[model samples]
Target: MSDDGDDPGRAGTGEPAPAEVGAKWARDRRNRVFLRRALAGVLVVAVVVVLGFSVRTSRLTDESGAFGPDLAPVMDRIAAENAEVEKNHPGAYVTVVAMFPMTGSLTDIGLNRESIRHGLEGIHLAQVWRNRQPSSPPYVRLLVGSDGPDDWEPTVEAIKARTADEHIVAVTGLGASTGTTRRTVESLSGSGYAMVSAVITSDELTGVRGLARVAALNSEQARAGVVHARKVNPGLKAVVIKDLNPADSYVKTLARFYTGSLADRERVMELSFDSSTRFSGTVLDVIAERVCNSGANTVLYAGRSEQLPALMQALSQRDRCVRPGMTVITGDDASEMNRKADLNMWGDTRIRLFYTALAHPAGLTLPGGEVLTAIRARFAGDDPDAFPRVFPHESLGDGMAIVHHDAMFVALETVKAFAREPDVPSPQDMANMLTSGTVAVEGASGPIRIVEGGARQTKEIPILQLNPDGTSAYSGRITMTDGGPGRS
Candidate 1:
């Protein structure tokens, strides 16, 4: 047993005398393989754990319910009321779907959380307001939905699933002016559902049938900005700074509209940059140089609010233009910009930042604003039935609630108009009327009259003046078409 081998089994055999060395190497190789396997297993476990956690924490986009927990109770309350309507009068109530960005995109920069919340509140108030009316024939019920950032098919399908039972006549609170928004609108329109969007301002959303918008078209907004720029400066020579990102319809249409309108009646210069990447410094500096040397007193910025400060800084700290003061009017996206934190954009310059907003409470003082006068009263805690009862008063300033209320108001009114007809109106009937140039809705934003085929809309465009202290004041409102027609 103590011969010269590591083990007694191999000692007697003439097989190997270096059996101990071979055994040690064999053990070492086995240990190495075991260790590698163990490490690999641990790595796999770690990856699985991380993936599990990510999946658990990620937001579910296809909930087919309220996007936020705070919205659940309000929707539940509406649901209870809907049930009561069904019990009282089975076929009297029609469903209305409110689709806004409740889940997908949220950020801290511009009160996005508050925007969504208030928008929902506005929709709820519209439903309540319409039903509480004494002569209500076709009562309104609400179904709230939101789509994922990438896919909208599920949301559209969900809406379609409820069509038989819910009796959805029209959709309101349609979201922003992006491609997803267009697709959703198109899908719904093709389904014969009338749509009333709260805040879509793209010019390219034409040819879609039965789609109406409470917001002004990009062309109208451009005309407002240009007219204001002319009022600010009589000479009226202007430079346009725009985002060249092709994906965003808001900026593209804004840039196109601005340049087109400016070229028509005034002296115009154009400068642009692609904000899809991080070219804020280099490209903006060059744009600023041209602006400074152009002898133009006005800047029509057709870009998003996030990159506005960079452009402002670029325009600042440069050789002065011959013009005394600079009037800068941005697109509706500037409504989301932070005024206080972004006040440094002025930078000891004569730049006055003005933006065209879809809505403002101050516009209530304009012509035909008394319809929405209750918004002001209720925000002061006046009516328990109207807005600010569910939402905070501070949310009033952002105009999300106002616009949503207006949009829902448009859809509900359209449905009601058909409800009064001889035969019961289906969604197709509502769709026909929404673009028939016959329905005139007085929304909170102003008046919305969708022309034939729903190509355009006439509503008041609110111009908000950005103050030095990083707050905005309602300057004035521009009446599109003298309240003529068309919103899509």
Candidate 2:
């Protein structure tokens, strides 16, 4: 090769390499370093995304998480189903609060409300809520007031506080007595919610707009008893031996209705009972004064069954001793009377004690019986029967299961209605739907339609009369001769 000292292509040329070549070399080195760093960063990000996704999926699908030991297995299943429902359908929740009865003469009404009647109906409602939307936020909470065998004040206060902060739409309990329930109802009135009661039997709950009762009204029961008595004994004379004290509002109402400007008005005698003599000499002295002294052949007992033993004790002490042929009719169930205590009606077949059942007529059957059977089958070990067994009357057996099934149906229907409506229904909306006279619901008792006054459908009450053998049977069906002001 020639020396060519000025040639650019020469190894020791005075000129540098081409600008493009120099730039390409530097760019290749930088690109290699950048590629390595970018690859490392991408790998780190990939790992983080996978971990986060795994955590989120686990939380959403895992049954072992979130709900602690407090929820029953059935409740857990319901909750899971509800979660799935809410996931699919946003902005939907079902909430239930039970105001149980506590401390009062009408505590028996509480037992019937909690275990046998309305309280049990509430639990069934949860199942209904879940069934309605098995994959949503089963927004159901039961704040059981500590009224049954415990102090319910704390529970009541806690719920009251929660109500202020939260959007609770419907309420349905505290069926202690009309008074206790009324205390609760009055507190929640105008808060815009509906309360459906199963056993608070007081007729006073009518026309409150948001309150509905599932139990037969006290006035209805009294009228049924009177009609049944009259049907069985045409010669019956009316003598009302009522505890005219303030505690017995049912008696007061009955007195007003029975003595409503009738020609036989003087036949009705009003007796006053005080704290000193609840079922003592006061009740019997009054009974003796009305039936024995005044020649009243038939008498009506409007007091509690607990008072019955004392009344009988006093009657037995009398000189004449509940004279024969003295036909007496009472509203209390003789079958539920103390089996050991002598009611003294054993020989006198003319004397009768009556009561009404909240049962449905024979022909009507509840919906979803087969579905309930299947649910029980799948959860045989888990006791799906917990809600249904609330009404444990073996006499009717499965026939009585209609009560719970119908309650569930009502709850489910309400949930569906809430879901489809343009507005997310507040509690009051649900109450309105339930209490609206237009909604004819088939309930556990019978074809339940809330009349304009918020009372359940009136069934033909069967009059059970006690026989000399200490057993009772339905003498006849009782009908309401008139719908009085006390009735609504």
TM-score of each: 0.76, 0.62
- TM-score quality measure for candidate 2: 0.62
The C-alpha stretches of model 1 lying farther than 4 A from their native spots are 1-66, 69-91, 103-111, 263-265, 319-323, 338-346, 366-381, 420-424, 455-457, 482-488
Among these predictions, the greatest lDDT belongs to: 1
- Please list the C-alpha lDDT of all candidates, in the order they appear: 0.67, 0.46
Clashing pairs in 1: 451-486, 456-486, 456-487, 457-486, 457-487
lDDT of 2 by residue, 186-244 (tens): 65665555666555555565677667665556677666666655655576666666555
- How well does candidate 1 score on lDDT at residue 52? 65
Q: Name the lDDT of candidate 2.
A: 0.46
User: CA shift at 106, candidate 2, in angstroms?
Assistant: 4.7
Model 1 lDDT-worst window of ten = 1-10
Clashes of each: 5, 18
Error of 2 at 258 (Å): 3.3
Q: Which lDDT tens digits does candidate 1 get at residues 1-488?
A: 11000133346666543334334433443455456657866866888788764212112122325456766656666677667766764545677877765545422111255566677777777777777655535666777666445546667777776565456778887677766777788888888887877778787886468887777777778888887777778788888888877667888888888887765557567888887776656888788878887778889998877677777766665757423666789877676752355345557447678888888877655554644454445444457675656554445666777888877877777765543243346678888888888766656665556778674456667788875555788877766674331221
